[model samples]
Target: MTTLTKNKVNDLIMSQIPSFGSFQTLREEGLAFLKEKGLPAMKEEEYKFTAISKKLEQSISDFSPAGKVVLNAETVKSHLFEGFDGDIIVFNNGHFDSELSSFQDQSYELNQLSESSPENLGKIAKIEKDPFVALNTAAFEDGIYIKVGRNKQVEKPIYLLFFNQANQGQIITPRILIEAEDNAEVTFLESSISLDEEAYFCNMVTEVKVAQNAHVHYNRLQHENKKAVTVNNFETDIHRDATFTSVVVSLEGDMLRNNLTLNLLDSGCEGNMYGLYLLDGKTHVDNHTNVDHTKPHAESNELYKGILADSSRAVFNGKIFVRQDAQKTNAFQQNNNILLSENATINTKPQLEIWADDVKCSHGCTTGQLDEEALFYLQARGIGKIQAKGLLLYAFAGEVLEHIANESFRKHIDALVQTRLGSSF
Candidate 1:
């Protein structure tokens, strides 16, 4: 492994100067924090299993911001959802592509990051500890601001399509802020993709605020080119009695690190997070998620599954923190991985830090191969070996996939999973 120092990361951050308008101070703080901690080193507690700093250094050593790539509707026609009817917002190369977006709804508003109010822009996304958030806040080229008005329910899911269509190596930072007003309800589906097998870095941050009693269901699908590297952070603040759910599906990438956090700021909130990573080749995926229970009577549930093949690797670090005042809190976490190849690697840790007496919390992790007995039984019952293995793996991953509320989207994911495993049945 190459030695990637903190100074080199900080130098890269400083080289790409940001032009933050009203949020300059926020960016400055992120720069300072990045300089202090640098990128996550392998020796760090949270990053011990994955050498993220090295991956980032290699991907972004000659990083430069790419110019606008001309994309028309026909270019992305094959990538769009076939039968889904929704408002689609497109971001090309980390910048909002208004010409490509098909959003004309009056109930919701989408604007550039610089157009948002200074007082509200940096309130929900605090960058005190995470340098990545600070870096995104300071250097993001362009992003989307989505606001669902009070008491309104969006009839259809709003789709955020982020496309990295580049032919060279560069770094792209995309920032997003979403706010759902009190009593509002919305569904969001976000997908990140790279059209070509080009080496690039996509650093993205999405901050969401769910107001009192608001309900949100967010689906994140990452299927970037295998030659690309992606670092994504998702932070959400749930208000009183609000419900927030996130389902992340990782299909392809060379190296990916996802940091997902949910903060229960008010009482009686519910947070649910689920993820599935199907990896092969030399792909590496790291998912670090945290749920903070700061209020009483909040409940949270988490489940993540991984299917690794060849020499791929997967890392999962899930933490649940119930503060002193978070009484009557209920939290549960489970991570399960199935390795199809002997060389596949998985590191999973489930952590619980609870100071509340009345809380019921539990965490567990399991990593192993498929059940040989079951495979043998299926094979003896006239099923082909490969088919039996595929069936077992499908059933194993279906637990997390079943949580998807959208039937169509769930089927789409199921198809992708089946294709990945070469399962014809």
Candidate 2:
């Protein structure tokens, strides 16, 4: 193990301190926290699979920071929105790009969090226990803050486009905050892309708050370059009778890690999460999710599927916690993976901690290769081996893709999947 010098670590932490000027207490507290805890080591259970401490030690002194990035209207038209028409928020190198975004609707307010009053920072500071959240709170330069008024239903989806165009070895931190008022309904689509071959580090945090009876649909697509590394944290708060649905699709990147946490603060809430990953080469993808049922009569369901080929590795760790008072809670979780090569690997763990006797909770996980009988049957029908394998893989992924309510978006993702599979299909 490489040793990280104290000065190097302090330098990285110091670079992140300027963004938290408004919250003086949090700023000081976070700095002290980092000084105490420092970078997460391999001993940390949450980071066991993807050992980042070594990477930090090797590159700490040579770390690069994102520089200015420019985008034009035509570029935005072609890359940001493309086919969808809605309120769009674009960020380049983690800074708001107002010139490339569109927000003409009246029912919604899209603004930069940095331009808002210092009071609003406290809203995100409330969840500072998470280390990544604290890091984002300290380092975030600019982000989109979208709020839908009460009793209003957005007719179009709110799109967020994040682009990374920094020099090689640049590191960027992007933050997002979304709030849906009571009885309001909205959809959010976030896409992350890269323009060049840079070894970048993206530490992003998204905080979502859903008011009573509100509905929110959130989807995230990650297609960054294989030379980049990303660590994303999603924290959500659901009120009484609210509904939250989240879909995550990851297709490219050298190493990617996502942490999703849902807090059921009130009763009668519904939460659903789905994820699909197609990994090849030496890629590493890890998804860690936690669903907390703090109140009664809440429902939570999760399904994650992975297709691993080559020597890639995937990890899924899901935990469902039912508090003692959370009686009558209904929770289900399933993780399935298909290994296409002998060396391809998957580590799946589903845990349920139920303190309430009246709750109904179950969890299961499965990892295996393709069935020989099914392959033989397809081959016997005159289908080529590669085409048959692609078909089988598509069918496995279709289970989650079928849940996409948007027809065009579903078709777009389907096309992306086919393209990734090469000429096999």
Candidate 3:
């Protein structure tokens, strides 16, 4: 760390003396760890492919406080789904903005962390060796906590929208916690966008807990700018007879890293994750997912696909662990990528560690260009080269998009995918 930047970071760290009252201990530990470890170097094994410490110093040169209403309803309305009706929770510069948000459903509990103290706030997403997680824990601004009652079904989908307008290069950390009680069902839609083209850094962490016989559908749309850098850490735990599904779409960004971890705590649990990233220009996107099958009769399915264009780069590392006691477990993972330009780069690793003799597990990865035979067939049928390529690319991306269950949200994502491919092709 340079003298100037180190001083800035140290000043920020010292400013967080009386952090959240109940979270003081966690914050102190996080601050101490961050001061000792600083940031991950480029030589680190996990962050070798995607380096962000230098990028953070470059993009986030200074710090500023942000709690103002930087966006109006009209500007915010343009980002919402055209015809979708749901609860809209808006956060400006990482703090909840009541004037810009509305919650119509009273069935589920949604409150700011500064107001309510929940038991599972930092349980699943415990601070680990990651510097980004520690930074978020020490200097988090505001957060949201959601809970659903037992056997109750939330009718409307909860939309968590975040807009960053800290024009002077700010580092924003947003925290979220969700709990689905036994036999409960709910859906969450999370998205982030920058109001300006200025550079900024966003560090986010979300933790979820699903009880017995419960179901949770979590979807995230990454709508970032060319100057935006993000690090997302997501952790979830599934109990007996519960199901958890997540779909992540990365459309554009300067540098984005996602660390997703899921653990099956009891038997009869199912976890599914699907991710799609469409990159162009000098964009970079990395996804690391870890699934641990600690109980028997649990199944996990993960499929991540990417289409890289121009000089863009992407990385996918998926690992599944089947413990010795986790018998009769079924786990499948696959990562497929396509490179359109000669300068495009991809590093994919699919891993499986099975200690149970009665388990069935498979993992593999594929990186190549679009199929020539298919392209030739499309062009041979009177289709233009550009149109044919777009069609093929969209079809390749459909495998992950089809996992979106909501009709309106699916169409919304489909439109975004088509527009992205059309421009690139």
Best by TM-score: 3
TM-score per model over all chains: 0.95, 0.94, 0.96
| lDDT to native, each model | 0.84, 0.79, 0.87
Over all chains combined, what TM-score does candidate 1 have? 0.95
Rank order by lDDT, top first?
A: 3, 1, 2
Clashing pairs in 3: none
Winner by lDDT: 3
Least lDDT summed over 10 consecutive residues: which range in candidate 1?
Answer: 1-10
**Residue 141 lDDT in candidate 3:** 67
Model 2, 1-425: lDDT tens digits are 12343455456667645644345565566566555556566667877777665664543343345765877777667674336778878888888888877878888777777566434453643434555565565556567677888999998887788888766555677877788899999888878888787677787888888889999998888888976688888888999999999889889888888998888989999889999999988888999999999999999999999999889889999999999999999999999999988988898989999999998888999899887799899999999888888888888898888766555566777888887765512
Model 3 weakest 10-residue run by lDDT? 1-10
Per-residue lDDT of model 1, residues 395-422, tens digit only: 9989998987666777878889888877
Clashing pairs in 1: none
RMSD of 1: 2.1
